[model samples]
Target chain A: MAVNKRETIAKNIARYFHDGDFVNLGVGIPTLSANYIPEGTEIILHAESGFAGQDGAITPPWDVNDREACDRELNNPKWADKENGWKIGHKDICDASGNLAILSKGASCFDSVVSFMMARGGHLDATVLGGLQVDEEGNLANWMVPGKNIPGMGGAMDLVSGAKKVIVAMEHNAKDGAPKVLKKCVFPLTAINCVSVLVTDICIIEFIDGKMTVVAMAPGMTKEELQKRTEATIHFADKIDVMDIVEE
Target chain B: MNKVVDIRTAIDKIKSGDKVAVGGFGNVGGPMNLLYELEKHPEINHLTTISEDFQMSETPYNQGFTGLLLNGQIDEIVVSFFGHKKAQAKVDAGEVKLTLIPQGTLAERLRAAGAGLGGFYTPTGVGTVVEEGKETKVINGKKYLLELPLKANVALVKAYKADRMGNAVFAYTAQNFNTAMATAADIVILECEKLVENGEIVPDQVQLPGVFVDYVVHCEEVHY
Candidate 1:
């Protein structure tokens, strides 16, 4: 069986995150990769809420309250002493992680100007976001749907502009079975020319020379097959690679 | 000390056809006084607003001011870009014109305008799709990209606290581009929630001094 879109996108994001990199995760499916950074990989997860090194999965429990925290910090030997650094609350950890941005000489609350400045100032190394659509130019349009009324645009815009490397992780198609990788987005924009890589369920796409270059694929999905489902032209790489591991 | 009512009236003085630059990154914090007063000016039109991202979905940015974007206004917008769905609709409807800029370039242009620079060349957009129909200059045997300065007639800034002198501070995440915007605008109007006494605000705590601020409207009716 072919690897699922979720696994494919998960692994694609793993490529950018090696070790000792400051990374920020968005709210949607991009949040799924919290525990999938691979074994022996050193990555510091930065939660905007203030967590610097918190780690955990969104507790999925069918028996109890299924909705749980998306973060967890295990008592790993390398992270902290077994007695010193135990399993900590991700929310508490993120909230404790304050940056130099917060120690500004003046201004108290979070303003748009300072917020965007931190983002635009390259505070975070990598930002993994979700998108409804990504074009050949690697432009992402995940904020809205054309006709469907929805919620307000979230931190996607800030994440895109400020993060050093922008990685989008999403499914291959829409709920109605429409291709999300399109020629152009039909909804309002969040940010323009900010997307760096398109990590989708079916394939891994990146903007090389202002065009989408397919560098990897789902286990069994070929470039031609991935293109068949996507409405936009598929710019395939000369060779496609296999995904590394499953999302833990 | 003007009451909340007078502050709202002061905001009402903002007429239509005003060029404004709002200080807010996404939407967490904004000048509620200005936004509220803008609601009264339904007669306002052809407004050019410069903002970071999601801060402009409200009334003044919604209807009163003409968007200088690829989607909002009839004229033109110089911004990093409108992302996702909104960009598509604006492009499809052919309602507005858009000039997209790289995030760094846009921030720098705004910063350059604030710093009183004519223009700067960066190798960022060079040799990529971002380089199209732009003047290319060779400097020191290398190609550099060029973008113009982003100046505004008026800049609207949001802050957490302020002194009677009109100095303001920004909240976290919301302080994206306020200072650069404050310098670029001809008249920088600050919308502050907390206004303390002149000496109440410490000199060290002031981010933008009252010298750059033209008007100070308190946050009387702003939603938290």
Candidate 2:
């Protein structure tokens, strides 16, 4: 079976997770990494919006009678269902016990400043972020497009620059077939020399000693094929390995 | 000091052209009731808002700070992420002025203001557009940009619980910028979901002490 690029990239990035690692996942493809986190390995996921443990859909326990009130209060139709207690969509949610927790399963929260302090002070072990463009020097440009109305950079700059290891989880090519891995980024940069690993649908690229090295490629893809799709100069390692695709 | 006050009375403290630093990452820690009340006061205009981001979504009730921005109560917004489509359109049409600061810098600048510091240097935006027209100094061999402290006339913050004395605690990720904004403003108004006795909250769990809070308002419902 053919693997989806995003899931492939997310699974590839998930391999980097270990027990007790503090990881921050960026909005898009990187968020998927949380679902593929290896079992028995406890990794803490950090959201820039000030969450530390979990991400994605959270279902809070609610009395059947309180469903409408929850719906009316949360302003989300997802919570309007009478059968399923309450289903509100939030970046983070708390429990009835008054602890800052994620209902996605379980998680903890802290003051927002403490979260950013961990992000800016290099306390995070690794951060998985989607990128618009990554250069040979490991520079990233994922925040803004010149002259566009895209929301400004939130925590990408701090996460990329402060995390011990920065991983780029993105598709190999743009929708228009342009390579996102470029010789030079036309988009405005989020941070300079921050990316340590580039995980794409087709291949995995690593920056070792300031050089872009191809460490693994997707099944049925060749180094030449990935090189054709990438605009940056791609150098292969002494031995190339097939990327491990974990089936969910 | 007794810091708990009625929401209507707290809203009256804001004046026209006041620089208001609001706490929130979108609607997470946003003081929506205070912002909503401030919107009704048409006399309050030309305000400058400092925050981490604009509204997270376009939901009418969850508008939060974006409600003030849409009502033209805010003339300038200093934030890290300014990408709300409606607000961005206003910025493009020259309706609102935006000053984009990196998220961490935004947090640190507010923190510096509360800590009573002049400014601090950071290497986050050295060669990017963020460095334009900013003071750059090299300490050792690395270049750093001097980011001044951000202060405001009034700050609106949201917390999960507040005691009678105004010592506060915040909910999960909802505590985003509230604690920092609480100390960076001249008058800090906290909107809380739960109100307790002065000593009801344990000392260790108190995120922002009463010294920094000026007013505490009990919000009946969770706005965000």
TM-score of each: 0.61, 0.88
lDDT per residue as tens, model 2, B71-171: 88889988888756788888888998998888888888889999999999887776677888899999998778898999989999988899978899876
Q: Candidate 2 lDDT (Cα, whole model)?
A: 0.78
lDDT of 1 by residue, B95-117 (tens): 54455555556566777887788
Spell out the clash pairs found in candidate 2. A151-B83
Q: How closely does chain A match the true chain A in each prediction, as TM-score?
A: 0.75, 0.80
* Highest DockQ against the true fold, candidate: 2
lDDT of each: 0.59, 0.78
Fnat for each predicted structure, in order: 0.10, 0.53
Model 2 complex DockQ against the native: 0.50
Off by over 4 Å in 1: A1-3, A24-31, A38-248, B1-5, B12-15, B54-102, B123-130, B138-143
Interface RMSD of each: 8.7, 4.3
lDDT of 2 by residue, A1-248 (tens): 66777888888898889898998877678877877777798887777666666533322334322536555545544443444432333433532111222333345566656777888778999988898899988889988877777677777777776789999987889999989999987888888888899999888999988889999998889877888999999899998878867544
Determine the TM-score of chain B of model 1: 0.79
